[model samples]
Target: MRVKKQKRNRRTVKFFSACFGFREPFKVICDGTFIHHLLAHRLLPADDALAKLLGARVTLFSSRCITAELKSLGQSHSESLEASLQLIPASCDHEKRVNAAACIESIIAEGNGKHFFVATQDIELRRRLREVPSVPVIYGLKNSLLIEQPSTAQREFVKCSEEKRLHASVSEIQILRKEVNETDQGRDSFDPDQSSRTRTLKRSLDSTEKSKFKRKRAKGPNPLSCKKKKSKEVSIPSPNKEGSVPAKKRKRTRKKKDSGLEQGSGS
Candidate 1:
Protein backbone atom coordinates (compact mmCIF):
# COMPACT_ATOMS: atom_id res chain seq x y z
CA MET A 1 0.00 0.00 0.00
CA ARG A 2 2.85 2.38 0.85
CA VAL A 3 4.56 1.55 -2.44
CA LYS A 4 1.43 2.33 -4.39
CA LYS A 5 1.03 5.67 -2.63
CA GLN A 6 4.63 6.58 -3.37
CA LYS A 7 4.23 5.67 -7.01
CA ARG A 8 1.11 7.82 -7.28
CA ASN A 9 2.89 10.73 -5.64
CA ARG A 10 5.85 10.36 -8.01
CA ARG A 11 3.54 10.31 -11.03
CA THR A 12 1.88 13.55 -9.90
CA VAL A 13 5.24 15.17 -9.37
CA LYS A 14 6.35 14.11 -12.84
CA PHE A 15 3.18 15.57 -14.37
CA PHE A 16 3.89 18.96 -12.81
CA SER A 17 7.56 18.76 -13.69
CA ALA A 18 6.95 17.99 -17.35
CA CYS A 19 4.10 20.42 -18.06
CA PHE A 20 4.68 23.26 -15.60
CA GLY A 21 8.51 23.31 -15.52
CA PHE A 22 8.98 22.31 -11.87
CA ARG A 23 12.71 22.01 -11.25
CA GLU A 24 14.92 20.20 -8.75
CA PRO A 25 15.15 21.51 -5.15
CA PHE A 26 11.47 22.31 -5.18
CA LYS A 27 10.08 25.23 -3.14
CA VAL A 28 7.23 24.34 -0.78
CA ILE A 29 5.21 26.98 1.14
CA CYS A 30 3.87 25.56 4.39
CA ASP A 31 0.86 27.08 6.14
CA GLY A 32 0.23 27.14 9.89
CA THR A 33 -2.30 24.29 9.91
CA PHE A 34 0.05 22.02 8.01
CA ILE A 35 2.90 22.76 10.43
CA HIS A 36 0.73 22.02 13.46
CA HIS A 37 -0.43 18.76 11.93
CA LEU A 38 3.14 17.68 11.29
CA LEU A 39 4.20 18.34 14.88
CA ALA A 40 1.03 16.77 16.33
CA HIS A 41 1.46 13.69 14.17
CA ARG A 42 5.14 13.44 15.12
CA LEU A 43 6.18 13.87 11.51
CA LEU A 44 9.30 15.60 12.76
CA PRO A 45 12.04 16.96 10.54
CA ALA A 46 9.50 18.30 8.05
CA ASP A 47 11.95 18.82 5.17
CA ASP A 48 13.00 15.18 4.93
CA ALA A 49 9.41 13.88 4.88
CA LEU A 50 8.25 16.40 2.30
CA ALA A 51 11.37 15.76 0.19
CA LYS A 52 10.69 12.04 0.15
CA LEU A 53 7.07 12.68 -0.83
CA LEU A 54 8.13 15.03 -3.64
CA GLY A 55 10.88 12.66 -4.83
CA ALA A 56 13.36 15.56 -4.87
CA ARG A 57 15.27 17.74 -2.47
CA VAL A 58 12.96 20.54 -1.20
CA THR A 59 13.34 23.96 0.34
CA LEU A 60 10.51 24.56 2.86
CA PHE A 61 9.10 28.08 2.88
CA SER A 62 6.80 29.95 5.29
CA SER A 63 5.54 33.49 4.87
CA ARG A 64 5.42 36.06 7.68
CA CYS A 65 1.63 35.76 7.78
CA ILE A 66 1.85 32.01 8.37
CA THR A 67 4.44 32.42 11.13
CA ALA A 68 2.30 35.11 12.82
CA GLU A 69 -0.76 32.86 12.63
CA LEU A 70 1.11 30.00 14.25
CA LYS A 71 2.45 32.32 16.93
CA SER A 72 -1.08 33.47 17.83
CA LEU A 73 -2.12 29.89 18.63
CA GLY A 74 -0.59 30.21 22.13
CA GLN A 75 1.71 27.67 23.79
CA SER A 76 0.02 24.64 22.21
CA HIS A 77 1.56 25.53 18.83
CA SER A 78 4.83 27.02 20.07
CA GLU A 79 6.74 24.05 18.67
CA SER A 80 4.95 24.40 15.33
CA LEU A 81 5.71 28.13 15.37
CA GLU A 82 9.38 27.38 15.90
CA ALA A 83 9.33 24.93 13.02
CA SER A 84 7.64 27.48 10.75
CA LEU A 85 10.12 30.15 11.78
CA GLN A 86 13.02 27.89 10.85
CA LEU A 87 11.79 27.68 7.24
CA ILE A 88 12.93 30.13 4.55
CA PRO A 89 10.65 33.16 4.44
CA ALA A 90 8.72 33.66 1.24
CA SER A 91 8.02 37.30 0.25
CA CYS A 92 4.56 38.30 1.41
CA ASP A 93 5.16 42.13 1.43
CA HIS A 94 2.14 42.52 3.63
CA GLU A 95 2.30 45.53 5.92
CA LYS A 96 -0.56 44.07 7.95
CA ARG A 97 -0.71 40.39 8.67
CA VAL A 98 -3.57 38.50 7.01
CA ASN A 99 -4.90 34.96 7.43
CA ALA A 100 -2.52 32.22 6.32
CA ALA A 101 -4.91 31.01 3.61
CA ALA A 102 -5.38 34.55 2.21
CA CYS A 103 -1.66 35.20 2.24
CA ILE A 104 -0.93 31.95 0.38
CA GLU A 105 -3.67 32.66 -2.18
CA SER A 106 -2.21 36.10 -2.86
CA ILE A 107 1.23 34.60 -3.38
CA ILE A 108 -0.04 32.04 -5.91
CA ALA A 109 -2.44 34.42 -7.74
CA GLU A 110 -3.98 32.98 -10.92
CA GLY A 111 -0.84 31.44 -12.41
CA ASN A 112 1.83 29.96 -10.15
CA GLY A 113 4.75 31.66 -11.95
CA LYS A 114 7.17 30.86 -9.10
CA HIS A 115 6.20 27.17 -9.20
CA PHE A 116 5.40 26.78 -5.45
CA PHE A 117 3.99 23.63 -3.90
CA VAL A 118 1.42 24.59 -1.22
CA ALA A 119 1.28 22.39 1.88
CA THR A 120 -1.81 23.08 3.93
CA GLN A 121 -4.33 21.16 6.05
CA ASP A 122 -7.12 23.69 5.43
CA ILE A 123 -9.73 22.13 3.16
CA GLU A 124 -10.94 25.51 1.86
CA LEU A 125 -7.41 26.56 0.93
CA ARG A 126 -6.80 23.28 -0.90
CA ARG A 127 -10.04 23.69 -2.85
CA ARG A 128 -9.12 27.23 -3.75
CA LEU A 129 -5.64 26.18 -4.85
CA ARG A 130 -7.17 23.68 -7.27
CA GLU A 131 -8.68 26.53 -9.30
CA VAL A 132 -5.26 28.04 -10.00
CA PRO A 133 -3.23 26.43 -12.83
CA SER A 134 0.18 24.85 -12.20
CA VAL A 135 -0.10 25.02 -8.38
CA PRO A 136 0.52 21.62 -6.76
CA VAL A 137 -1.16 21.00 -3.36
CA ILE A 138 0.24 18.76 -0.65
CA TYR A 139 -1.65 17.54 2.39
CA GLY A 140 -1.22 14.87 5.05
CA LEU A 141 -3.38 11.73 5.22
CA LYS A 142 -2.83 9.99 8.58
CA ASN A 143 0.97 9.85 8.93
CA SER A 144 1.60 9.90 5.16
CA LEU A 145 1.99 12.92 2.88
CA LEU A 146 0.35 13.03 -0.54
CA ILE A 147 0.39 15.41 -3.50
CA GLU A 148 -2.93 16.21 -5.18
CA GLN A 149 -3.55 15.19 -8.77
CA PRO A 150 -3.88 18.00 -11.29
CA SER A 151 -7.34 19.52 -11.23
CA THR A 152 -9.61 19.97 -14.26
CA ALA A 153 -8.81 23.69 -14.43
CA GLN A 154 -5.10 22.92 -14.59
CA ARG A 155 -5.60 20.29 -17.27
CA GLU A 156 -7.69 22.68 -19.36
CA PHE A 157 -5.10 25.40 -18.95
CA VAL A 158 -2.39 23.01 -20.16
CA LYS A 159 -4.47 22.07 -23.18
CA CYS A 160 -5.18 25.69 -24.06
CA SER A 161 -1.52 26.60 -23.72
CA GLU A 162 -0.49 23.71 -25.98
CA GLU A 163 -3.00 24.73 -28.63
CA LYS A 164 -1.77 28.30 -28.56
CA ARG A 165 1.75 27.00 -29.20
CA LEU A 166 0.64 24.76 -32.11
CA HIS A 167 -1.09 27.64 -33.90
CA ALA A 168 0.15 31.09 -34.84
CA SER A 169 -1.12 34.29 -33.26
CA VAL A 170 -2.83 37.15 -35.12
CA SER A 171 0.32 39.28 -34.93
CA GLU A 172 2.44 36.46 -36.39
CA ILE A 173 -0.08 35.87 -39.16
CA GLN A 174 -0.03 39.58 -40.04
CA ILE A 175 3.78 39.54 -40.18
CA LEU A 176 3.81 36.53 -42.49
CA ARG A 177 1.22 38.14 -44.77
CA LYS A 178 3.28 41.30 -44.96
CA GLU A 179 6.39 39.32 -45.92
CA VAL A 180 4.54 37.48 -48.70
CA ASN A 181 3.13 40.74 -50.08
CA GLU A 182 6.59 42.30 -50.16
CA THR A 183 7.95 39.32 -52.12
CA ASP A 184 5.06 39.43 -54.56
CA GLN A 185 5.51 43.16 -55.14
CA GLY A 186 9.23 42.64 -55.73
CA ARG A 187 8.50 40.06 -58.45
CA ASP A 188 5.68 42.10 -60.08
CA SER A 189 7.73 45.29 -60.51
CA PHE A 190 9.61 44.36 -63.71
CA ASP A 191 11.64 46.96 -65.69
CA PRO A 192 11.42 46.84 -69.50
CA ASP A 193 14.72 48.72 -69.97
CA GLN A 194 16.58 46.26 -67.69
CA SER A 195 15.06 43.30 -69.59
CA SER A 196 16.10 44.81 -72.99
CA ARG A 197 19.68 45.38 -71.67
CA THR A 198 19.85 41.77 -70.44
CA ARG A 199 18.65 40.48 -73.84
CA THR A 200 21.30 42.50 -75.74
CA LEU A 201 24.03 41.24 -73.34
CA LYS A 202 22.92 37.66 -73.93
CA ARG A 203 23.00 38.16 -77.76
CA SER A 204 26.50 39.62 -77.62
CA LEU A 205 27.69 36.69 -75.50
CA ASP A 206 26.19 34.19 -78.02
CA SER A 207 27.91 35.91 -80.94
CA THR A 208 31.28 35.85 -79.16
CA GLU A 209 30.88 32.14 -78.30
CA LYS A 210 29.92 31.35 -81.91
CA SER A 211 32.98 33.23 -83.28
CA LYS A 212 35.32 31.26 -80.92
CA PHE A 213 34.39 27.90 -82.54
CA LYS A 214 34.66 27.14 -86.34
CA ARG A 215 31.86 25.20 -88.13
CA LYS A 216 32.80 21.82 -89.68
CA ARG A 217 33.20 21.81 -93.60
CA ALA A 218 32.25 18.93 -96.05
CA LYS A 219 35.19 16.41 -96.48
CA GLY A 220 36.09 13.50 -98.84
CA PRO A 221 34.80 9.96 -98.25
CA ASN A 222 36.57 7.82 -95.61
CA PRO A 223 39.74 6.04 -96.96
CA LEU A 224 38.57 2.75 -95.38
CA SER A 225 35.38 2.78 -97.54
CA CYS A 226 37.40 3.01 -100.89
CA LYS A 227 38.87 -0.17 -102.54
CA LYS A 228 42.65 -0.83 -101.97
CA LYS A 229 44.99 -0.89 -105.12
CA LYS A 230 46.39 -4.39 -106.09
CA SER A 231 50.24 -4.79 -106.19
CA LYS A 232 51.73 -5.88 -109.71
CA GLU A 233 53.44 -9.35 -109.89
CA VAL A 234 56.69 -9.25 -112.13
CA SER A 235 57.40 -12.68 -113.87
CA ILE A 236 60.92 -14.04 -113.00
CA PRO A 237 62.47 -16.19 -115.87
CA SER A 238 64.28 -19.55 -115.10
CA PRO A 239 67.60 -20.57 -116.91
CA ASN A 240 67.11 -21.44 -120.65
CA LYS A 241 68.00 -25.10 -121.52
CA GLU A 242 68.41 -24.20 -125.30
CA GLY A 243 71.35 -21.81 -124.52
CA SER A 244 73.11 -24.54 -122.32
CA VAL A 245 74.80 -27.85 -123.43
CA PRO A 246 72.59 -31.07 -123.26
CA ALA A 247 73.50 -34.04 -120.91
CA LYS A 248 74.60 -37.39 -122.66
CA LYS A 249 72.13 -40.38 -122.62
CA ARG A 250 73.40 -43.69 -121.05
CA LYS A 251 72.94 -47.08 -123.09
CA ARG A 252 71.79 -50.23 -121.17
CA THR A 253 73.15 -53.82 -122.21
CA ARG A 254 70.89 -57.10 -122.13
CA LYS A 255 71.97 -60.56 -120.64
CA LYS A 256 72.06 -63.73 -122.98
CA LYS A 257 69.99 -67.08 -122.48
CA ASP A 258 71.97 -69.70 -120.50
CA SER A 259 72.09 -73.57 -120.08
CA GLY A 260 68.27 -73.84 -119.64
CA LEU A 261 67.73 -73.43 -123.42
CA GLU A 262 70.57 -75.99 -124.38
CA GLN A 263 69.09 -78.64 -122.02
CA GLY A 264 65.65 -78.19 -123.61
CA SER A 265 67.12 -78.75 -127.10
CA GLY A 266 68.91 -82.00 -125.95
CA SER A 267 65.60 -83.33 -124.37
Candidate 2:
Protein backbone atom coordinates (compact mmCIF):
# COMPACT_ATOMS: atom_id res chain seq x y z
CA MET A 1 0.00 0.00 0.00
CA ARG A 2 1.15 3.54 -0.81
CA VAL A 3 1.28 5.67 2.32
CA LYS A 4 0.77 9.41 2.15
CA LYS A 5 3.59 11.59 3.42
CA GLN A 6 2.40 13.60 6.41
CA LYS A 7 3.36 17.28 6.58
CA ARG A 8 4.63 18.88 9.73
CA ASN A 9 4.15 22.44 11.06
CA ARG A 10 6.52 24.77 9.20
CA ARG A 11 8.89 26.49 11.61
CA THR A 12 9.45 30.19 10.95
CA VAL A 13 12.67 31.43 9.43
CA LYS A 14 14.72 32.21 12.49
CA PHE A 15 18.44 33.02 12.54
CA PHE A 16 20.86 31.10 14.75
CA SER A 17 21.11 34.01 17.20
CA ALA A 18 17.34 33.92 17.82
CA CYS A 19 17.20 30.35 19.16
CA PHE A 20 17.52 29.47 22.85
CA GLY A 21 21.15 28.98 23.92
CA PHE A 22 22.23 30.80 20.80
CA ARG A 23 24.78 32.66 22.85
CA GLU A 24 26.21 29.45 24.31
CA PRO A 25 29.38 27.98 22.92
CA PHE A 26 28.71 25.70 19.92
CA LYS A 27 30.86 22.60 19.39
CA VAL A 28 32.46 22.28 15.95
CA ILE A 29 33.48 18.76 14.88
CA CYS A 30 36.46 18.96 12.52
CA ASP A 31 37.87 16.42 10.05
CA GLY A 32 41.38 15.94 8.67
CA THR A 33 40.55 17.88 5.51
CA PHE A 34 39.19 20.87 7.43
CA ILE A 35 42.25 20.89 9.68
CA HIS A 36 44.60 20.75 6.68
CA HIS A 37 42.63 23.49 4.99
CA LEU A 38 42.80 25.65 8.10
CA LEU A 39 46.59 25.27 8.14
CA ALA A 40 47.12 25.80 4.40
CA HIS A 41 44.87 28.86 4.14
CA ARG A 42 46.26 30.45 7.35
CA LEU A 43 42.71 30.62 8.68
CA LEU A 44 43.52 30.10 12.37
CA PRO A 45 41.36 33.11 13.23
CA ALA A 46 38.34 31.64 11.35
CA ASP A 47 36.89 30.55 14.70
CA ASP A 48 36.45 34.24 15.59
CA ALA A 49 34.61 34.86 12.32
CA LEU A 50 32.29 31.91 12.97
CA ALA A 51 31.64 33.04 16.54
CA LYS A 52 30.80 36.51 15.36
CA LEU A 53 28.48 35.21 12.64
CA LEU A 54 26.61 32.82 14.98
CA GLY A 55 26.72 35.21 17.94
CA ALA A 56 28.39 32.53 20.13
CA ARG A 57 31.77 31.10 21.11
CA VAL A 58 33.05 28.17 18.98
CA THR A 59 34.63 25.10 20.66
CA LEU A 60 36.48 22.71 18.36
CA PHE A 61 36.16 18.93 18.70
CA SER A 62 37.74 16.03 16.80
CA SER A 63 38.12 12.26 17.07
CA ARG A 64 41.11 9.94 17.05
CA CYS A 65 39.93 8.73 13.67
CA ILE A 66 40.47 12.21 12.17
CA THR A 67 43.84 12.44 13.80
CA ALA A 68 44.76 9.10 12.24
CA GLU A 69 43.67 10.43 8.89
CA LEU A 70 45.83 13.51 9.24
CA LYS A 71 48.83 11.35 10.13
CA SER A 72 48.33 9.32 6.95
CA LEU A 73 48.09 12.57 4.93
CA GLY A 74 51.85 12.81 5.43
CA GLN A 75 55.11 14.37 6.66
CA SER A 76 54.58 17.72 4.92
CA HIS A 77 51.39 18.48 6.85
CA SER A 78 52.54 16.91 10.18
CA GLU A 79 53.68 20.23 11.68
CA SER A 80 50.46 21.94 10.63
CA LEU A 81 48.35 19.05 11.95
CA GLU A 82 50.17 19.14 15.30
CA ALA A 83 49.48 22.83 15.68
CA SER A 84 45.78 22.30 14.93
CA LEU A 85 45.57 19.38 17.35
CA GLN A 86 46.89 21.57 20.17
CA LEU A 87 43.95 23.92 19.63
CA ILE A 88 41.22 21.22 20.04
CA PRO A 89 40.45 20.74 23.77
CA ALA A 90 38.22 17.67 23.45
CA SER A 91 38.28 14.45 21.42
CA CYS A 92 36.32 11.19 21.11
CA ASP A 93 38.80 8.31 21.17
CA HIS A 94 37.06 5.11 20.15
CA GLU A 95 38.93 1.81 20.41
CA LYS A 96 37.49 0.52 17.15
CA ARG A 97 37.67 3.66 15.02
CA VAL A 98 35.85 4.35 11.74
CA ASN A 99 36.25 6.97 9.03
CA ALA A 100 36.21 10.68 9.98
CA ALA A 101 32.70 11.09 8.49
CA ALA A 102 31.09 8.30 10.51
CA CYS A 103 32.85 9.39 13.71
CA ILE A 104 31.65 12.99 13.40
CA GLU A 105 28.10 11.84 12.62
CA SER A 106 27.99 9.53 15.64
CA ILE A 107 29.31 12.25 17.98
CA ILE A 108 26.66 14.66 16.77
CA ALA A 109 23.91 12.07 17.06
CA GLU A 110 24.96 11.30 20.65
CA GLY A 111 24.79 14.99 21.50
CA ASN A 112 20.99 15.03 21.08
CA GLY A 113 20.37 18.38 22.73
CA LYS A 114 23.71 20.16 22.40
CA HIS A 115 24.30 22.53 19.48
CA PHE A 116 26.88 21.25 16.99
CA PHE A 117 28.54 22.33 13.75
CA VAL A 118 30.41 20.22 11.18
CA ALA A 119 33.51 21.79 9.54
CA THR A 120 34.37 19.94 6.35
CA GLN A 121 34.79 20.71 2.67
CA ASP A 122 34.09 17.13 1.51
CA ILE A 123 30.99 17.30 -0.71
CA GLU A 124 29.91 13.77 0.28
CA LEU A 125 30.40 14.51 3.99
CA ARG A 126 28.36 17.68 3.71
CA ARG A 127 25.54 15.78 2.00
CA ARG A 128 25.52 13.14 4.73
CA LEU A 129 25.49 15.76 7.49
CA ARG A 130 22.67 17.60 5.74
CA GLU A 131 20.48 14.54 6.24
CA VAL A 132 20.74 15.06 10.03
CA PRO A 133 18.34 17.72 11.35
CA SER A 134 19.15 21.09 12.93
CA VAL A 135 22.91 20.67 12.49
CA PRO A 136 24.79 23.64 11.02
CA VAL A 137 27.59 23.16 8.51
CA ILE A 138 30.68 25.36 8.09
CA TYR A 139 32.83 25.12 4.99
CA GLY A 140 35.35 27.22 3.02
CA LEU A 141 33.49 28.79 0.15
CA LYS A 142 35.37 31.26 -2.10
CA ASN A 143 38.15 31.64 0.49
CA SER A 144 35.59 32.55 3.15
CA LEU A 145 33.78 30.56 5.89
CA LEU A 146 30.05 30.02 5.29
CA ILE A 147 27.27 28.37 7.34
CA GLU A 148 24.18 26.51 6.07
CA GLN A 149 20.96 26.15 8.06
CA PRO A 150 19.00 22.84 8.08
CA SER A 151 15.79 22.53 6.08
CA THR A 152 12.32 21.56 7.39
CA ALA A 153 12.55 18.13 5.71
CA GLN A 154 15.72 17.39 7.64
CA ARG A 155 13.94 18.16 10.93
CA GLU A 156 11.05 15.86 10.02
CA PHE A 157 13.50 13.11 9.14
CA VAL A 158 15.10 13.45 12.56
CA LYS A 159 11.67 13.17 14.26
CA CYS A 160 10.81 9.98 12.42
CA SER A 161 14.21 8.48 13.16
CA GLU A 162 13.75 9.14 16.87
CA GLU A 163 10.27 7.50 16.85
CA LYS A 164 11.68 4.36 15.20
CA ARG A 165 14.50 4.24 17.75
CA LEU A 166 12.01 4.44 20.64
CA HIS A 167 9.83 1.68 19.19
CA ALA A 168 12.81 -0.64 18.78
CA SER A 169 13.86 0.01 22.38
CA VAL A 170 10.36 -0.88 23.67
CA SER A 171 10.34 -4.14 21.69
CA GLU A 172 13.75 -5.09 23.06
CA ILE A 173 12.53 -4.50 26.63
CA GLN A 174 9.49 -6.79 26.08
CA ILE A 175 11.68 -9.53 24.63
CA LEU A 176 13.99 -9.35 27.65
CA ARG A 177 11.00 -9.60 30.02
CA LYS A 178 9.73 -12.73 28.26
CA GLU A 179 13.15 -14.32 28.48
CA VAL A 180 13.27 -13.61 32.21
CA ASN A 181 9.85 -15.21 32.77
CA GLU A 182 10.90 -18.35 30.93
CA THR A 183 14.09 -18.56 32.97
CA ASP A 184 12.11 -18.29 36.22
CA GLN A 185 9.75 -21.08 35.16
CA GLY A 186 12.65 -23.36 34.36
CA ARG A 187 14.22 -22.69 37.75
CA ASP A 188 10.95 -23.35 39.62
CA SER A 189 10.29 -26.64 37.81
CA PHE A 190 13.72 -28.06 38.58
CA ASP A 191 14.00 -30.66 41.42
CA PRO A 192 17.28 -30.14 43.18
CA ASP A 193 17.07 -33.12 45.60
CA GLN A 194 16.04 -36.38 43.97
CA SER A 195 17.07 -38.59 46.91
CA SER A 196 15.10 -36.54 49.43
CA ARG A 197 11.93 -36.75 47.35
CA THR A 198 12.20 -40.52 47.01
CA ARG A 199 12.70 -40.93 50.75
CA THR A 200 9.64 -38.83 51.55
CA LEU A 201 7.49 -40.89 49.19
CA LYS A 202 8.56 -44.18 50.85
CA ARG A 203 7.87 -42.77 54.33
CA SER A 204 4.33 -41.73 53.32
CA LEU A 205 3.53 -45.19 51.93
CA ASP A 206 4.76 -46.95 55.10
CA SER A 207 2.65 -44.65 57.33
CA THR A 208 -0.49 -45.42 55.30
CA GLU A 209 0.03 -49.17 55.61
CA LYS A 210 0.54 -48.92 59.42
CA SER A 211 -2.66 -46.93 59.81
CA LYS A 212 -4.63 -49.59 57.90
CA PHE A 213 -3.24 -52.39 60.06
CA LYS A 214 -4.19 -50.55 63.27
CA ARG A 215 -7.78 -50.02 62.05
CA LYS A 216 -8.18 -53.74 61.28
CA ARG A 217 -6.86 -54.77 64.73
CA ALA A 218 -9.23 -52.38 66.55
CA LYS A 219 -12.28 -54.12 64.97
CA GLY A 220 -12.35 -57.42 67.15
CA PRO A 221 -14.82 -60.35 67.05
CA ASN A 222 -18.18 -59.74 68.90
CA PRO A 223 -18.94 -61.86 72.11
CA LEU A 224 -22.66 -62.38 71.20
CA SER A 225 -21.73 -63.67 67.75
CA CYS A 226 -19.28 -66.22 69.35
CA LYS A 227 -21.96 -67.52 71.81
CA LYS A 228 -24.52 -67.95 68.97
CA LYS A 229 -21.99 -70.02 66.98
CA LYS A 230 -21.28 -72.31 69.99
CA SER A 231 -25.06 -72.99 70.56
CA LYS A 232 -25.62 -73.83 66.91
CA GLU A 233 -22.68 -76.28 66.95
CA VAL A 234 -23.98 -78.12 70.08
CA SER A 235 -27.53 -78.46 68.62
CA ILE A 236 -26.13 -80.20 65.51
CA PRO A 237 -25.49 -84.06 65.87
CA SER A 238 -21.85 -85.24 66.26
CA PRO A 239 -20.87 -88.76 65.02
CA ASN A 240 -18.71 -90.90 67.40
CA LYS A 241 -16.71 -94.11 66.68
CA GLU A 242 -19.65 -96.49 67.58
CA GLY A 243 -22.59 -94.16 67.08
CA SER A 244 -23.35 -90.43 67.70
CA VAL A 245 -26.40 -89.41 69.66
CA PRO A 246 -28.93 -87.46 67.67
CA ALA A 247 -29.60 -83.72 68.30
CA LYS A 248 -33.02 -84.69 69.87
CA LYS A 249 -31.38 -87.02 72.45
CA ARG A 250 -28.96 -84.30 73.47
CA LYS A 251 -31.86 -81.89 73.96
CA ARG A 252 -33.85 -84.46 76.17
CA THR A 253 -30.89 -84.94 78.52
CA ARG A 254 -30.47 -81.19 78.84
CA LYS A 255 -34.22 -80.76 79.74
CA LYS A 256 -34.22 -83.47 82.40
CA LYS A 257 -31.24 -82.02 84.17
CA ASP A 258 -32.87 -78.59 84.19
CA SER A 259 -36.16 -79.98 85.75
CA GLY A 260 -34.35 -81.92 88.49
CA LEU A 261 -32.36 -78.86 89.48
CA GLU A 262 -35.56 -76.75 89.64
CA GLN A 263 -37.45 -79.23 91.92
CA GLY A 264 -34.61 -79.38 94.47
CA SER A 265 -34.56 -75.58 94.65
CA GLY A 266 -38.37 -75.46 95.40
CA SER A 267 -38.08 -78.01 98.31
Quick one: best TM-score, which candidate?
1
Query: Which residue pairs show collisions in model 2?
Result: none
Model 1: CA > 4 A from native: 191-267
Q: Which candidate comes out best when scored by lDDT?
A: 1
For each candidate, what TM-score against the reference?
Answer: 0.71, 0.48
Per-residue alpha-carbon lDDT of model 2 for 1-267, expressed as tens digits?
Answer: 111101110121134334323345777777877777776777757577566545567787767777777777799879656855765644465778678887777677743356667788888988877766666677775445656665665667656866886675777989999999998888778787955787899999999988888744466878877855344444556777779664544434443467878899999
Candidate 1 local lDDT, 1-267, one digit each (tens) = 989988999999998999999999999999998998898888878999999999899999999999998888899989889898899999987999999999998888857788999999999989988988889999998898889999999899899999999999999999999999998887678787867898999999999999889788899999999999999999655545776544555888888879999899999
lDDT assessment of candidate 2: 0.66
Per-residue error (Å), model 2, residue 218: 99
> What is the overall TM-score of model 2 with all chains considered together?
0.48
TM-score computed on alpha carbons, candidate 1 = 0.71
lDDT of 2 at 10: 12
